[model samples]
Target: MGAGLSGLACAITLEKHGISPAVFEVRERLGDRFVNAESMLSILQKPITDPVAFFAEKNGIYLKPTASIQRLLVFSQSQKAEIEGSLGFINYRGRHEHAFERQLGRQVKSAIQYRSKATYEELLMEYTHVVVATGDGEYTRKMHNFRTDLTVSLKGAMVTGDFDRYTPCAWLDYSYMEKGYGYLLPLSDTEANLVMAYPDYPENDRLDVDERWGLFYERVCRDLRQPLRITSHFHVTGYPIGICRRARIGNTFFVGNCFGALMPFLGFGQFTALLTGIYAAYDICGKGAYEELTQPLRRSYENSLVLRRAVERLDNEDLDRIVPVLGSRWGESILQGKSFNALRWLAFALRPWMTKR
Candidate 1:
């Protein structure tokens, strides 16, 4: 039960089938507590093919699709590479609900009970089917014991400044220690997103998030040969940047970063969250309106586990090589080809379970 993109999507899907899904969100707003803009790649890959459009159409809302498509610059521990693809970009929800959050909110506004949190006992007593979308590990202890955990640690900082020079350049620098990388994604001409992760790095273990971010920000500026003009700063908003221990449990389903967030190396979890939610919707509908739908939830959860493993492998291997070569002439050449696009699409289609919607 959450109000984030995943939970909203799940609720909307159920309502679409006339099931009248009830949502319990811990927060008051449709989006989570975080302030940074998330990256969307696949589900919104194309304007017409995007789920935002689908939800808007079904719910009678006007959602204007904004395309900030660009190639991903992967920074591996060892080298750099460029991944070419049609990346889908959307703002979650802010005002008029023009982004991902607004579209999903419009679908399930009446169903969601904002500021109402559900405990284990309270949840089991209420809905006949409970879908757990909260990003809290403590809540799932008794009912679900998921062994899936992440090794990497995630830390981030949001800065509002002129990133105009790096707008489309979106650099992914991996000059950090082994299994660590720095990211620079441009949200707009005035906004830039910076995130860094370390799988085994423990520099922040001894210090609080602010202190660690202070040190990290200093380092990033030094490397970039620039000054830190942070008009606004939000750093290391959360801790222990690892995947969730479990995804699905009994009649409850999980989606989004709650299941397991991919490492920053992939930078596709935002897209994955929406895709997984859609897939969960499909699974629920396929089983028909009955408690028997729990079976498909289990299968989807198992499938997520397998996909997470593959992602771990990719993070540990390809990323170290890919990050260094981003934004280069060679990277541009690779992205300009149609063969790479075909291969990427085929690869995702080949693994239906892992495909990002």
Candidate 2:
């Protein structure tokens, strides 16, 4: 029902099957939000290495990534690690000329009703089938279908800096915020998106976001050895990271974050979100069962949740030890290998460490 990635993908898929569907978006235009960049990590999407190729060849959904992620630099409180490979791809999100939403918007033939206040109840009375891709869990929550694992507070900005377009950096420091992480994904040689995400637990309710961001920003500058100037910024609080218990109820289908596409581990769900939308379209076309098509994605989400729980038990000392391992041959093997499930193995491997401290 929304014109975000999943909604547009749903419309495109329906169009491919000769079915024209009405699309609605809450925003005035596509990409009408803060500009940022997100990674489609190959390590996260195992067995299928290249998400861009996989989407086109498997689902007939073609998408262009901003750049191939060839290197990953991770920093802990006392350790730094670098991993190099065809790690993944980066895609610009939000308001940008080449943003993912705009790209998907271009592929759809149907007109999207912007500033749409159309509710699901009203739509249900008209359309034979309704696909809820509102890009959030609110509607699902209202239906008593969403199970929230945790809520996160995020502060991010588009910054001008000297950056390596092929490399993404991550920071794991608890001094600024507990169980929080920061990342930098370059849009180009001179521009990048820097973001910090942390759990919005009750204990953190009184924490100052600006103070935390300031510390994180300084750390990034020191680590990169380049001062960055903020071009634009965004802040979000109490953003739910969870799943819907039911993907569908009656003729209504839920895709994207509405259907629990956001994984708890790192919260990246673009690949799963696109697949769910396509799967919903497939089911609508009598080609497959939506629930069955999305079973693997649900499994991945569960696996990520387990990993997130294990990671929650770790402290800065634990990260100091683990960061180096991530750059080691064993870690490289796990990340590079395509045969086994990397997420599952990672969660399993963290069991001992999680119990130790």
Tens digit per residue, CA lDDT, model 1, 1-357: 776666776776766666777778777766554555555444222223344454456543334444455556443434545555554454533333455676668767456787895675688787776766675434554445543344455566556655542223332333343334566656666666576655544643444545545665776565445774665444342332234444555666666665543323343454445544555665666644322433443333344444444444454445545545444767554444433542234334546645443
Candidate 1 local lDDT, residue 169: 32
lDDT of 2 by residue, 1-357 (tens): 888888888899999999999998888999798888988988887888999999889777778888999999999998999998899999988888788899889889988899999999999999999999998888999999999999888889999989899999999887778888999999899999999988987656778879879989999999999899999899978888899998989999999999988888888889888889999999999999998988888888887888888877789999999999999989888888888777878777776765576
Over 4 Å off in model 1, which ranges? 42-67, 71-85, 90-99, 141-144, 151-154, 164-178, 200-228, 237-249, 261-267, 286-357
Q: In model 2, which runs have C-alpha deviations exceeding 4 angstroms? A: 348-357
Q: How does residue 14 of candidate 2 score in lDDT?
A: 95
Query: Each candidate: what lDDT?
Result: 0.52, 0.89
Each candidate's TM vs. the true structure?
A: 0.66, 0.96
